[model samples]
Target: MKKEMYAFVVPCSARPLVFDESRCVGCNRCAEVCQVDILIPNPEKGRPPVVLYPGECYYCGSCVMACRQEGAIRLQHPLMNQAKFVPVRHAADAGEEKPLPAEKRRG
Candidate 1:
């Protein structure tokens, strides 16, 4: 028998990354090391990597470390050291009791 499966949707930062063209050398190291496989290297030479799927990024800075060229890939401020996992509830879950306001909320 086949087992059941479920999927969850989550919200993440929109502008999660920025590639410094001046620092990148088209070596494709960053693309190779990314855990989420978001970075895509250009076919042409001397071009910076592209973030194909920014929302899936884990912001682990593996790309930054892999870059020996200095400041080639930056994960942006506010989201640099911060990673948010917002669980999106479906319509079926809307009937659940909502949390109380901060002033009335219990510890």
Candidate 2:
């Protein structure tokens, strides 16, 4: 009899979801609630679900919300997808009265 080895490749650059092994209960709820079907239940009992298609994840946080265990599952959006906050200067702060559009300006 011969034994075969199987390997699953997960992209290193982007991990849309992360599992906290210590906190995970492996109830498979996360996998069930995934709208994109990117996650699958692990064959081994009491182990975290597998991220079969990390790239296919919608980053919708459904899995995290479905999990009963706190900190068991988390959504990690890629750097490009993360939100950035920019400070905006109001017209008063800038000390400028911007002209309105010609159509909107009063005669």
Candidate 3:
């Protein structure tokens, strides 16, 4: 049986964002949108961008949205590989359709 409705049903207690250094095209698009209140500029040099407030991330998918490369930005949620995503049953579970929290749903 599935566990109780977790305000944070996510598996990992704390997960960090992982980047593909090679895939990053240095478009700086992710950095642009994140300037307001999303992320901090990563000084590292690579395809995958970096951030400051990783834990504070709202998972808005903006960085990924601005990504022009194939595999530039990737979200590596905590206990992701170990976690299994069960489809949302009721109307409450379904929030947005376009980006259905791929990391959370990846079983």
Which number leads on lDDT? 2
lDDT string for model 1 (1-107, tens) is: 59896333344566666778888898999899999887677767888876777778866888888988878777764535557778765433666454654342222
Instruction: Name the better of 2 and 3 by lDDT.
Output: 2
Residue lDDT tens for model 2, 1-107: 58896537466579888899999989999888888887777889999988978878877888888889999988988988789988865665667677874343222
Please, what is the TM-score per model?
0.57, 0.69, 0.50
Determine which window of 10 residues in candidate 1 has minimal summed lDDT: 98-107
**Model 3, range 3-85, lDDT digits (tens) per residue?**
77423223335555566777776667787876444444455554444454555666667777777886777766556545777
Off by over 4 Å in 1: 1-13, 77-107
Please report the TM-score between candidate 3 and the true structure: 0.50
Number of clashes in model 3? 2
Error in Å for residue 86 of model 1:
26
By descending TM-score, how would the candidates be arranged?
2, 1, 3
Poorest stretch of ten by lDDT in candidate 2: 98-107
Largest TM-score belongs to which candidate? Answer: 2
The collision pairs in model 1 are: none
Q: Which residue ranges in model 2 land beyond 4 Å of their true spot? A: 1-7, 10-12, 86-107
